[model samples]
Target chain A: MTVTATAGQPAWTHSLFRSGWLDGSALNFFLEELNPAWSLVRPAVRIRQIIEETHDTRSFVFKPAWGFGRAIAGQHVGIGVDINGRRHERRYSISSAPARGLVTITVKREPNGKVSNHLHDRIKVGDRVFVSPPQGDFVLPSPAPQKLLLIAAGSGITPLMAQLRSLLSGRYSGSIVLLNYVRSQQDRIFGAALDELAERHPQLSVHWCLEKENAERFSASQLQQRVPDYAERFALLCGPAGFMQVVRQHWHEQTLDERLRFEYFGTPQPFKPDDKPAGVAAHIALARSGRSIVAEANQSALAALEAAGETPSYGCRMGICQSCRCRKVSGPVRNLLTGAVSHEPNEEIQLCISAAEDDLVLDY
Target chain B: MKKPHPSRALSPQEQDALAAELDALRDSVVADLGERDARYIRRIVRISRYSAVFGRIALMFGFVPLLWPLAVLALGVSKILENMEIGHNVMHGQYDWMNDPRLNSQTYEWDNVGTSDNWRKTHNFKHHTYTNILGLDDDLGYDITRITGAQRWNPGYLLQPAYNVVFALLFQWGVALQDMKLGRYVLGRRPLTEMFAKLRPIVRKSGFQLFKDYLFFPLLAGPNLLAVPIGNLIANGMRNVWTYSIIHCGHFPAGVRIYTRAECKNESRGHWYARQMNGSANIEGSRLLYILSGHLSHQIEHHLFPDIPAHRYPEMAPKVREICERYGQHYATGPFIRQFGSVIGKFFLYAVPNLQRRPRTA
Candidate 1:
């Protein structure tokens, strides 16, 4: 049931992708400790049983031969798997609790996910994987036993289950109001385990619902009415981008709720849009001798001013990223990032990103 | 089978082309900074250190009754330039081993020299990150600049080159202003450190003294001190172009080009090596070149290994060049005259200050 639910990757992951993360700056720090590229750390876990959660989601259970360290419910670790010729890595949260060492990873296959699909079809028990230490700030707040809420639409329940298992094991005895919804009752993952947990803990309650369930099962409306205690609990919602949007719109009346926590799947949101401007166009040239390409534009006076020829030295094309920066040879440039303007602007403008509105020349 | 966005977005052919160009350029930049240029920088660090000592002695004797009082003043100018560069290099952690706390503050102490803001920003951030990002780069053309460089002669210059002489001869008028202007740039661009924070109060006072002495002293030079004024005029013109030509020579090579964000993404670190090599050319390592290049003649080495002491760079540069060649990269370098010519080409054809770039053909 949770198979299809867990397969969906949130859109926020795109934000976390950065170039310097693989940089040599860390080279100095880690060079003596490990090889420049790969490091062998202590083993994280030993694969045990694989559980099929839903149509698209499957949980690979692993027993920690070495001790599995504690991790925050929403935290993640970068897992690198050797596939074909490349070592592919991605971050994932452990679904099981620390005490069990039975690490359960609920994976949902995407259209062309490299590592995800590989894990789905090829991975099995006894396979050793390289993983980084636990990394992330998302977790349940301490000083527990307070009224808490856990909201998940699909596979977002992986981390929430960790929290629940933690509570069940007495690491944290917080009162949780776990509200998980799926397409149908049969699609609901951990249905048997959730019912058992509810039976064991007096304070732990589960409000499971299905948007489209069997005729005999309660629907979304009935489930909404069933969870009458939501108004009082802290909301930690995790799901797909579109799911969150719908959930947010559904509770627009309470949009200003202060106790809201969310974990999106992809990159962290930047303060501003990555594609804010139409972007400066310039006709930047490259020297005939070198391979450096220039940025050139026609409409922007600044870009036009830089567009002297067809060639210039450029490494990266995404402007505002700093690969195509060049000096002001003759005219003025209004820096797009910081609004200041100046000349004798030795390296005032990044040509690849900035466009020229005037006739310009570059040494390339 | 579906592929990730990366494999599909940049076609295999395009990636190959980008990769090839990147390797070629990186090789050029590394070789540009090689093993044979040790003596040139030795002179600058030595001259700066010795001149500073000379300036201190002259300051002590400036009260002499008949000892040609101008001797102290003359030595001071030589002291400031050499001292500033020495201060510049040391802030990069050059003198840490000397063990003089004043010479090597626990916190890399260039700020106390009243020159660099924080060595990190200028040396580490701007020089290293973008090395020379055209827009965001603070290395070559920050809104703020030392009063004595070509950007001074280039577009939107606030001062003229003749001020270096005026700064030397009629220095009472020009020196303070120069110091003040240079200070602002450092303050704005410097990577603030503990030493900088500690010396902030004094730096603020020296900054104030700039105006009081330069602007107010003219009324006191008593009108007939025209020799100082004539000297000031010569210095101004000489300083601007001299500094301009020198600084521009560091990164403004005919082969050197800037990369955009998109361009950088396609590039791996190996590719960045290409950018630095083709992006900057090393001029001949000569006494004159040393004075002008600030030992930056080893452009590729400096870019590749920023933390190694600049003095050591001349010795270690060849190893770096070899690395580039082994990697199938370019190490762009040449004689001083060739470098100077490249600067001229860059200034006219490219430095329009406009960032409009042409479509990059892989």
Candidate 2:
């Protein structure tokens, strides 16, 4: 048997070379050369539409420059934008379902948050912003639970809304109870949409805990009265620290820890401050650069290094990622995540969360 | 007070303040790392690959006589882009934050015959750390051509003009040989055994490059093998000349300073910054030329921040120039042709050093 050129190789090889490697080489290069922001590695997404969700929160819909892979509901992606001349990145949950070709991220303007305020005030429909591929562990399982209870407060509704949208779209047999805690009727995010979905689907139920209107908080007793079968459901709790604390205590008291799930929206606050002197300026010697600068006790080594114009790699400034690991040559450094102080001579420390306790040397 | 070196116009205290400010500027840029730098490199890599592929395809069809030179030029430009913008910057750990194994500084190998390991040791550490310091920086004259008045004149330098041309033609091989310290081996400074051990990687890398360019790609053309290899040879030569010119223009410009070993000893950060500014020169060009030069057009900024991404150098140049002005130091920068002309002029000037003058100290 003789093999011709087409017959010699497998069909998959031709398709692979035609689409995967050789496929968009010229077009991708052209797009990248025109504007680097549109490169496939960090695709620029143009805001297609904007929805005002509440007083301070807004949902921005974006059309990615390249073909974006569908993200699992509840997953977050880091959005990057150049505010002034500097780039800032902040992770936000994808509030839109995969079936919706456009991606959506709901933003709640924090009082002093740089990226949040920038996105809310400066970003507009038709403007482009760079986005990373969706990432995060807080996602619904492939075979989702039959009895799902989603408890959210304020902007925490973003991810849960995604889950609700996804569940509603699918042939889900589960009953979902959304116990949303808001300041008042005006503060409820996706209120009209949630109401419409609840009216259409018998399995979906919506409950609002308006703190200002009721002048009462959602205590364990109140939650029990609202949803008696909450203990039987797989509960996903997402809210501020105080709200999470109350929910966590209730779960712990009932020994329902396994049924509870949660996601933190921001860097977890360091536990009660240790007796280490606060706001003391300590000398930081950069070994490679052969320079020394003072790092305040209250500020992270990364922050100090950055303020001094040193570029150290970092991602997720919450001490979870090891991108900012540097050799602590000497002196005391405190781990912000764990209130442990190390006076070791040479050890690697994460610059993002490690604060200087005294004079120190770092291999930068 | 008597003046030391003309470039050392600032007092120690002023130098220290300038260094602190520059360091702070670098930190601020680093702290703001985001999509821009990442996208810049990714796009460059894609364009480089596209250029290479396009050039190879055109070369393979070398039966058409007109396509030969164009293919060679394209391939040469592609190689230059890869070596300078992508390979050099990535190997300097500029994009080390990306954590991609292929783009990593520690492991990335350029398309050139010179191995990445040797370049890191010789260029990244030795050349960057020592800069233009005499007896330490081999790059001062590349250990062969005497481009500065600091080096002692020898009868061998009479043939330097001719040797400079030969070095330019085979620049990649010259760099590989320089990394091996071939002159040290010839003079018996290092033993033949150790020299050969170091030359192993260079030889292996050269062989791989030869096989790919001369044999493999040509053989793929079957009957058109001869034309393809010849085209590749011309392309390689083009790349050699381009790199040789750009590199020499950066360090061998007329007004650029050369330091003595004693002056650089126990050098403070501020002093080191001063040395880098004095020693390096920049090429004035358009964005296209800057990209082609791998932003080494801003050589002064590069020398100051060897590990920072080179794409940032253009933005940093003005700030650095301001700092130099503040310190009353010369910031050498000019058009490429003028810079290259100065390098060529200096190449001849130092051929036979006049005994009337002594080497100046910092």
Candidate 3:
């Protein structure tokens, strides 16, 4: 049998061939035919319709021109737009019903966001966009959420809105709290529709939080205050980067099992903040001399340095991508993962994930 | 800096001692975490910082490293070019707590390890826990292989490396038979609900992701379309072969026992651990070896302390061995090259249930 038949093999894939295994032989047939190479799924979607969501937000309904589906909701697609000829991709949550033939994705223009801004301005009703099908583990289980809190800030509500619409249209008999956060009254998405849904359901409540006009910052405390007592209320929060950060800074900190859900608005770079190398404070203190040296755990070392006020040089942050890699002169740094430490006795470190463990001096 | 080996073993007493030690060694490992590690990191930071500053200068100077090479049809090692090590490590949950040291973030959950409900219970649990337990370890002819009485091989698969796409390109016909034949034989009578509920989602997405990873990127490797796929084909083929050799080398070796459930239960925990050691092969626990196999060389450490991060195994190994030695249990281990030979011997010893292999037709 060929690899095609056994295609869905587990992806613990690595060196399956040797230096000369595929050389000058019919086994080359198996090499190319059986082993997984690349190019399976991509976005390749055609926009079918558009719905005005808010002042800055809009829902773009798209259908795969080819075969797709077999994917779930909360799953995201990497939509590539050919703008100025450089193909740029932005991963967006599939805000549409999985049962529906076409998947819906709602995009809110980022004020200074590159792709988001380009998409909002240039993408049209009949545009064909390249996209990867639902690439995240963010979908809700079927049977609908029993008591759900669909949280959103800015346009982060797109996916949750999709979930909400799917659950409601499917005759879901559950209570849902839609915590909609916006800068002002002009920014709320699906506002009137939510209001009407809330009026009819009685169990569904729409908590609108517009920060500029709502006086108090619609914060975790306020969120906590709203859902004060519940043995089982699932929170699906989304929004602007800062807004989601704030929500995460506030939501269920003491637990990780079964209560919270996250649909981050950032690229999937393993959205982790805990992998900062040891002695971050010490380096911050050292780098702080005459320069603002705050450790941006979200960034590479060079990125953090630049953000901190140092002009630094770098390349690809991926190890093999060796663009932003540098020579380690001295000092110990802990690997963000596996928490292993490597000392100065080496060539260079990948600063993208490396953090200093002491008050130190860097080459640049 | 490097991945810890996956086959590190701990004596019974050391296993108990490790649990206690980890609880107490919190933050204390930093003291012994030497200057070499520190300097290596700082240098990387420095080089990275300088490279960024200077690369922009170079780009301004009209120095396009990759682009210029792409011009000459012989780009040196574009396979290494596309390999996303960061993505690999991040997927393994390595980067989650790299910053805060508090493990405050949740990493992308893979098939095995951790108690997170999200992990797809692929043959991972079966392959690792049961090793070569035939009729139980569905890993042999799982969702990947094409056995007898299975999906007929499609010639179009020669275009791409992964089997799924070859199958898809031919027709979505053969996958069911392949899955049925192996999945039927290896996936024993666990609760049907357990399979559907726990494993289905992971199996579903992973299958598609496999196609995407194998076919999607290669088909679009670069400006030259064929260059993209051909390059991917080479890289992916190499990666798969290495993975296959390392994997089968561990369990199929001679002297390893493939026990039934009754045999497994009757053995004491120590003996059971010994069974795992006996069943699996140990590669060298070198830094480089750990990396190539996702540190699975410390398979014993992996089995003993699945929850403890893989990096901690090297540090804990010597201590673990001391305890195992004291217990007088067979803590199986050997260099990787030696283990590889053993596995080849075992491969013949425990032949795959071949009645299911596809029939040869003229």
Tell me, by DockQ, which candidate is best: 2
Ten residues in a row with the worst lDDT in model 1 chain A?
A1-10
Candidate 3 per-residue lDDT over residues A1-364, each given as its tens digit? 0000001111222122111121111222223233312223232456789888777787888766333545565666656654432234556776666774677777777666566777778778877776554566666766666888777777777677767777776778888888787788988777887888788778788888778886656654675676664336787877656666666766546463367777666532222445456634434332123342545333446656776766554332322222344444334565553355654221245566576553323334
Better structure of 2 and 3 per DockQ: 2
Each candidate's fnat, listed in order, reads 0.00, 0.00, 0.00
Every prediction: chain A TM-score: 0.61, 0.70, 0.62
TM-score of each: 0.38, 0.68, 0.36
- Candidate 3 residue A311 Cα shift, in angstroms, is 29
Instruction: In angstroms, give how far residue A88 of model 3 lies from its true place.
Output: 1.5
Candidate lDDT scores, in order, read: 0.49, 0.78, 0.48
lDDT of 2 by residue, A10-44 (tens): 23323432332233334444666687556644566
In order of lDDT, best first, we have 2, 1, 3
Local accuracy of candidate 1 as per-residue lDDT tens digits, B1-362? 21211111344454455556544543444334332223333455455445434433443343455422343344334444443345445544343322222223112222122333333334444566665544445554334333212232355332422333333344322222322334544676654474466556445544543432233323334542333333333333343344445555677665555544556654555455556655566766675455445467787766654433455556666766665565545566778788877655443443343344443332
Q: Which residues of candidate 1, in runs, are more than 4 Å off?
A: A1-50, A61-69, A82-88, A99-103, A171-175, A214-224, A250-252, A267-364, B1-362
iRMSD of all candidate structures: 18.2, 11.8, 18.4
